[model samples]
Target: MIDLNNEKLELNYPCKWIYKIIGKNNQDIKKAVKEILDQREYVLKLSKSSKKGKFKSFTLELLVHNEDDRKMLYDILYNHDNINMVL
Candidate 1:
């Protein structure tokens, strides 16, 4: 078995990356993403919501030029006020 913690996963540069964002409001999440990614092309799709509808989730896909770009996007989303969780 491979030890994921000790191994690095190879990723091609300028590839598509997907982020799963969960938040209290879908519109708020979209707005936050738009504000951060302004002018960049991306795809956003509604993934799901809580049973009582208190929370929502979305799948955001975009092109990442390299590791820094991909990780930077994750940091931005993870630090956004409107976003509760990121994966």
Candidate 2:
């Protein structure tokens, strides 16, 4: 089996990246994403929700110019209070 823990993703710059964000409120998550992205071209889609309707998942798709930009976006979204997690 592949060791997922040790496997580092190899990706080319200026490619599409997806951020899977999960949180308690859909609107809150949407607002957070909007604020962070701030007029940048991107696609946001509602993926699914938890069984009890307690959590929501959204996928944010956008083109990242470089490793720093990609990682910066991830950090921005991950640090937001309205966002519970980002993957």
Candidate 3:
């Protein structure tokens, strides 16, 4: 028998990290995620973007493997000229 309440949840174990990516271009998000989180086990959650005449707003949620991976991704996207920002 197992008791759920008796178990303690520790964050020591490696878990996926989520990053909310914001940009003015959809292609930028795709490229950034690919260049950053691609080839690694991750899930990308994209928000519906509004169609503004000359402006665009988009968001992407990326699931990273660990802290190191998240840092690597941040550096990649942050340094990229096409990427607006990553949170």
Candidate 4:
């Protein structure tokens, strides 16, 4: 089996990146993304929700200019109050 802990992802710059964001409310997630990615073109889709209806998830796809830009977006989403997880 591959060592998941030591695995590293190599991504090319200026490529399409997808962020899976989970939260308690879908609207809150959308608002947060909108505020962070203001004026930037992106695609957002409702992924799924917890069976108990307590959490929701969304998939955001966009073109990242570079590694820093991809990481920056991850940080922004992770810092959002409504967001519970990012993957």
Per-model TM-score, in order, reads: 0.92, 0.89, 0.60, 0.88
Candidate 3 segments exceeding 4 Å error: 1-10, 48-66
- Model 1: lDDT equals 0.94
Off by over 4 Å in 1: 1-5
What are the lDDT figures for the candidates, one per model? 0.94, 0.94, 0.63, 0.92
Q: Which stretches of candidate 2 lie over 4 Å from their true place?
A: 1-8
- Look at candidate 3 and give me any clashing residue pairs: none
Instruction: Give the worst 10-residue stretch by lDDT in candidate 3.
Output: 53-62
**Order of models, best lDDT first:** 2, 1, 4, 3
State the displacement of the C-alpha of residue 49, model 1, in Å, after optimal TM-score superposition. Answer: 0.4
Residues 1-87, candidate 3, lDDT per residue (tens digit)? Answer: 777997875554255556666666766667767776556665666655557533344444445556676677778877787766667
Tens-place lDDT per residue, model 4, 12-62, is: 789999999999988898999899999899999999999999999999999
Q: Write the per-residue lDDT of candidate 1 for residues 57-87, one digit (tens) a residue.
A: 9999999999999999899999999999999
Q: lDDT per residue, candidate 2, 1-87, as tens digits? A: 767998788998899999999999989998999999997999999999999999999999999999999999999999999999999
What is candidate 3's CA lDDT for residue 41?
60
